[model samples]
Target chain A: MSYRTIDRGAAATPEPVARKIRGLSDRAIAWIFVAPTIFLLLAINIFPLIWTIRLSFTNYKANRINREPEWIGLRNYERILTDSDIWLNMQATAHFLIWTIFFQVLIGFALAWLINKKFKGNDLWTTIIVLPMMLSPAVVGNFWKFLYQPQIGLFNYIIAFFTGKEPSSFEMLGQVNLAPWSIVIVDTWMWTPFVMLICLAGLRSIPDYIYEAAEVDRASKLRQFFTITVPMVLPFLMLAVLFRGIENFKMFDLVVQLTGGGPGSTTELTSINLKREAFEKWRTGYASAYAIILFVTVFGLASIYVKALNKVKER
Target chain B: MAYSKLATASAIAIAATGVAHSAQAEDLTLCWAAWDPANALVELSKEFEAQSGHTMNFEFVPWPNFADRMLNELNSGGQLCDLLIGDSQWIGGGAENGHYVKLNDFFDNEGISMDDFAPATVYAYSTWPKGTPNYYALPAMGDANGWFYRKDWFAREDIQAAYKEATGEDLREPQSQKELLQIAQFFQGREIDGKTVYGAAIFTERGSEGITMGVTSALYPWGFKYENEPGSYDMEGAVNSPEAVEALEFYKTFYETATPPGYTNSYMGESLDAFKSGQVAMAMNWFAFFPGLYADPATGGDKIDFFVNPPQNIAASTLGGQGISVVSYSDKQDAALEYIKWFAQPDVQAKWWALGGYSAHNSVLQDPGFVDSQPFAGDFLEAMDGVQDFWQEPAYAELLLAMQKRVHDFVVADQGTAQEALDKLIEDWNEVFEDEGKL
Candidate 1:
């Protein structure tokens, strides 16, 4: 059959199907189309969140499901807030998040700016630099652990060669002073590429004519960079920061594989502490309270950050 | 027509086999830590499978994750394991939580006496009230924290002369905790056969129970106690005793000045790796691993020697072992009980020891040639005689994590003084007991 004939046949639906839907309004049909999704959202996301909020007020242990949980009137929240060890975990988390975002943005922007210049093998260099981002964080954490090994690791050997110190004199993952930095280094190595790609997009998005226009006004190269290049890329840079900020706030797998929050709790992030409470210690109710607190902190901060990002975009 | 005839014939054959064995066969799964003994148990269960006409399966988790995995399984009432050989620390939780079948009635009916097992194993691995006759499991593997060393290095003449010159004493097996530290310090960063070797590999692992187990080896020898008196929960002076501080400081010294670089999170596997790879002069691990270590081609035979954790104020070894129990949730309880029955036989336990699984049976342990059976056998007996265990309370996970943090803070991370760390540990334990309503 001709294409037009088939089209006509499809367009004019059979009489019974058309009559079945004849009385329905567009909104009702739309609801029909979206109801399953709404049901799923309620079942999986909303219900669990509400349950967690309820559990946060109780003294429930997940492993002891047979025992009835007693209502403790926010005692879990009270204790978690007062716990000194928890404060230490928060400080460790803040240190990790701030340092990782700082290094990633700094190095990521530099690499993106360098690569933005049309040079030989530029695409190949971009691909090579982005290789670390492609790897699983767990895998990155695992291999970096070996690399940070003090005795026979390549990292120690490199430092020794330059500084003329013994290779085994310093331990990156074993020392309280160095362990936090060790995690920062691995995170920068693994995730800087992600930030770079975002920054690269920002760098590429700036029209070349703007640079040409600045040059027409006899602007210096440095002047063009400060006035045009930086201002134009600020929004994307902020977006990358927001993403890394929220992600690093809840960071677990990479740091866990690398440090398992040791050398004291020097590298124990808030998320690691949460997991220990919830799963290892089976303090489900307390961990629920802990999770809610972390959620509020991140959500409140990110909401403010997104508003700033939008304002930057408008500018 | 021919197909129908063949189907009928097959049905007749099935019925004939079903009639021959009235109790229909079932597949039974037994879960335990994945180690040398699990492999031995798998080999040993082949005989049980043949006799019982039941297919045997296993679920073996690594030691680091065994408690977390198996406890979750039992807590959730998962049918994964019909029988479980769980850690000694888990007995209270298992029994009190109703995850394990109460085996007292089964034992009574089957005529299996708990008296046939070593008293220490029976007390440590099977009881919830601890040292009581209330049984929840059969003591399967008896283990304790023990030490091994490079005998070949100790036998070196130049080393002996160097040791004599350094300390004005003979270099031999460590007689006490102080001497052990002295020898370990001597080996640290010393060149041996063109390779720079560390002093020793002890457990400094932060996650789970590594540091607690390792530090307790030192603590127990110094006469450390969890409470001022037994069952009192009064830990102000005892848990933070001067002896505990000294022991903690000694372990910290070992970690800081002696052990291999990047040995912060080392545990049983790492200890084994250090010994087998010839990286350390000495190492600490469980007696359960000794058979495999002895049979190892690379670092076994004349090259190795074993010692119980050396005494300081008193003789004590950290108990390490587990008992076998039928999970209450299992539908195949009869089959699992049959396996347990077969396992308790004297002959089977003797074969179990022969195959590298530590048999706690008196028949095997009291045998005249038991010491001569293996080089480390005498030390194993000595260690078991003095074995002490950490809290086997249902709140053990909480109790253990608290110690892991406090000890790791002092010893590995250098965060606080040993006295301060122990004080914090007592506070943490106090909070846990209060929550459990036992204080």
Candidate 2:
């Protein structure tokens, strides 16, 4: 089957072009094919990063082009590390990231397990469950804002109907104590399906013969689930957690549309704070340092987490 | 017969030349905030188009992200706008960064004097170093923060009796800041026509300039100042004065005790919606939206009325307006200048005010019927007379954001004492000024 295809490819390439290609060594040919990608990676990914690192040591303001930037050494980093507001933003980010992952992983695995079982209208339920994730985060944020409104929101109405309280008794997005959890609930609602799909893939990858062999061994249902199902899906669950964690770390648009990092900085995650510094405040050099610190933190965490995932896979 | 054919050819040549002259007209894009007044500007510009052969295009952005979008365009040296109706706070940056063309010569050549416009507008919207007239723009719109209320409810007998019984005073327009708060509290949770209505919808939004502008209405009246002395960045007692603390605490009390439940992150649009939908008894917004509000069939006419923001310690209001500047990067400088020169005329400004765009020209403001022109006209003039503005420094954004965070923290989040909030604000401002080498 391959001889005809190979002959047709040789005939399709012009004779002079094929000869030129055939003259080059394999390594050079490979480089010829990949040079554009390398150039693109350098131009987009590497060069800007290097430039940002340089700017981190200077006092360059993006809006003040008339003024010359001065070299300020590590002063920008020093100031960032010492700023209490920045630390508070970091804590807010941590709170969001950890809770969102915890909730997403918990509900996602449960949904995947239940959907894995044979049931009527399973595909329909699965599609319904995945609907929230299909919408834009901005759209989700805007609609959820209406839902969280106290006077007219459907969410407050649902709460009031259950608790026999007034619909205007509480504000989900307005109060300090509830605003953080409000974002958490929305994030969990939108992204749990993403984790569920991954978990579903994990659950489906387990062969039927394994369960049959466990049945032959007289293994109880509880023992087989604890031993086989949980352990096998552990790697997939960890992968989902890693993906959601990185994403929630950079959560900006949804939170912006919801609270705008407020009820006074209670929901001011680091990304939103960084945007204020960079764009709103135009503290370019300081923001550059902030960005580098965030980049390193994410890169380091992902590297360590990836290593752990690989180890789990090996096990 | 040959002579007649030649004469016909000459007539065709003349007609083609006229068409070519018409085709030479430049299309000028004027950028501004997307609001009711932007529509007025569009309608008014039709006159400019007929007068000058240049077509007008507008790129209107919503208020929340207007600064972010337009600043990015300017920072990138984009040619998207030939003229920009930028906020007054941007005059410093616009002049310093060369984003706006210096208009001193243009004004002189066109026989336009700075004295022809309102002094406050010229100082806020046209100058760079506070009062020095390094003109970068022409004052296009004049506005200030003011209040509007439900006039029909105030006249209700039962409501008036209830308010009098509750506060031992007749329900009328508030004369002081405390009276305003008292009135708002009286309206809070009051049942009207079998529907629960709240006090007011004031700005508490955190992302942009909403809360800062709203709070400044109180701050300015309480005699808040950016500096202890003019041209000095000394903000020690001036920013954290007892008066300012009182004003800030007053605003917080208003927010806490009066505003509708779940009205936390509201700005201008939300405030307008609250008043229009009969959810609030009083609401605060810029005077620019008054024309549209008065035109609202349900809420306007006899149902609503305007008031200048009541004074606390002194007479003051927050300024809300912009100057129209020719973008330096635009290639259509001549056409853009022509638009400005045409706009600065007394007749055109009169037309602008008639079409609902606020005109800062003295000729319009000093008209015999100016005060009696509309119901809000007197209040607008009063508000503009005592209007105060935030810092117009190039780093005004940073300063405004600092105040936004500190004030929002104390007022909306109930986090800190009023004194502490102002003290922390002083610290933030000091840091910014230090960064700018102005400390």
Candidate 3:
């Protein structure tokens, strides 16, 4: 049919379908709405990462404000890999992350389970338990250092009272043997409550009907818990693990306040080492490489953890 | 003709506005640490502004992160600061990176004399490579590391009698390493003023540069060398020689037996706390802190006295201080240089020292009344006279970190034997030098 004949089919021009079947233009308008968000994401996140990657291959001292920078091509990465101090800091960080996660999760989950039971003043107890995680890490680190004092501290007093011996003890921040564990204790004391809160939320979500069904089946309380409660709380526990893992991997502020990565490099975590290299040592190119390595490592671990979390959710 | 006249008048008005703007922009900014010294400098700088007719901008950073903050601002080539009072440790890196203007020609052109300032202070902090190029920085604060003790405790007849009975000699302030050890031993765990007090406490903090300051005073007098016979930067045996090892062992013994039980974590603040609390009979610290020590009524009431760090093989302490520098990136260089010159005058420097500051001017420090003005003035002057600095190489930061690591391991951690600590320190120092092509 001719184009004119299609238009002449009805009286008054059949009102020319004012609402066109607009498809591509509507999608184009939708993209226009999201363009700012895409630009923002690329500007804030992607740009810095690309810049850091570029700096990693150069010999740019971030502190050297005026010197013309030259490209060195992976020399900084080579140097970081070979540097014993960098490796030592990585080891310290690994030790801290693994141990702190273990203790925080174990203790937090236990506390959550205990508090989940119906008891008098359970709400008050839970509030009191989670209060430490609310305090600033700097405040916790400073006060804990004072509490860890060998002679004059209350911790020593407690030990002396129970053992009835003279209160001479190891220096917490000074001696290397005790310093790393000192950090561990402080970190656990602060963050274990966070894990506990997550576990509690998970525990509270368990329906009573599931327990009732298990009871009808004449199952033991332990058997019911193993079958119903644990599987239900598994996703929450993984979430708690993911958070604490990411947090402890970048631990800097508390260590800075408590020991300042000291009694001499004994507790210098990777972040602290990176900061020293970047700021104090003025080795910006090298520190950028160090940061990239840490970032990649954390990113890889988090991706794996997210996959595990997906599996838990599916189950 | 009427239109031409109007255009000329308008052009003349705009040119006048530009001239006025130029005059108003003649202002300078000064940055320094936030403390008594900075307050005194601010007071003195106002006089310069009054006389020179230039505005002043002062930025006083807290002592902890002052270096990092200033370096960031300087490197960005921003005019956030024009002049700075910087720690001596920052001179090498700051100068080499062109963050500061070389002041030799400026000093010459203005008839400004560096001789009026303390030679040691200028030699330690102002020159790059320890007196090579006049690259950047000027002498501002002339603080030096020194030892302080309770003169009353040292003068006690009972302590003297007890020490004489035990060692078969009269107890006097030690002048050599062996004697210093003996003196420290004599007062270990002594009951004084009806309270049990320790003999001495020198800071051994693993953080920052506290331990390095303590170890340097002991190392300087043991015939140690910071440079080789050919006059290159050599800190090998100097840091961990047999004599240095012996000195460290003695220090460890003093720490274990003579120091307060909680001294390993001691920093400047803790040392002050211990001294103020009367728990320590002796301490080694910065001379600038003498004002703070004397200002406190608890310890300032004629209870605390001081002496220079006792001589070992040579009488020296770490050349500790800061330098005033003009930012090369700043447009207000002329104004800043004028303010610095005004600050260096003897009369102004005397006021600076009198109003709770350490004078960097030689004339001001040497004035007869300087000793009588402040309680620790005599000791301060004596300590400043005996100042020696660390290697002022461009790689000084790396060198300091390397030294701190080894010294901390030996003294605080006891992770390795003294010999092993020294051997590793040598290797590390050589590694740094090799990387810089200094070896």
Give Cα-based local distance difference scores for all models.
0.92, 0.94, 0.79
Q: Which ten contiguous residues of candidate 1 chain A have the minimum total lDDT?
A: A14-23
**lDDT measured at residue A308 in model 1 versus the true structure, 0 to 100:** 91
Tens digits of lDDT, candidate 2, B163-236: 98999999999999899999999999999999999999999999999999989988998898978998888888
Instruction: Give the range where candidate 3 chain A is weakest over 10 consecutive residues by summed lDDT.
Output: A14-23
| TM-score leaderboard ranking | 2, 1, 3
Q: Candidate order by DockQ, highest to lowest? A: 2, 1, 3
Candidate 3 lDDT by residue in tens digits, A66-133: 55678889888888888887788888998999999999989998999999999999999999998999
True contacts kept of each: 0.71, 0.79, 0.53
Query: lDDT, candidate 2, residue A167?
Result: 95
Across B1-439, the per-residue lDDT of candidate 1 in tens digits comes to: 9999999999999999877655658889999999999999999999998887889999999988887888888878899999999999998888888889989989999999999999999999998788788999999999999999999999999999998999888999999999998999999989999999989999998888999999999999999999887888899999999999999999999898889889989899999999899999999999999998888898899899999999999999999999999999999998899889999999999999999999999999999999999999999999999999999988789899999999999999988799999999998999988877788
Q: Could you tell me the TM-score of candidate 2?
A: 0.97
TM-score for candidate 3, please give it: 0.89
Winner on lDDT (2 vs 3) = 2
Clashes found in each candidate (C-alpha, N, C closer than 3 A) = 0, 0, 3
Q: Compared with the true structure, what per-residue lDDT tens digits does model 1 show for residues A239-274?
A: 999989988998999988888899889999999889
Q: Candidate 3, which segments miss by more than 4 Å at Cα? A: A1-27, A65-74, B1-28, B49-57, B133-135, B229-231, B234-240, B368-375, B434-439
**Looking at candidate 1, what is the lDDT of residue B435?**
77
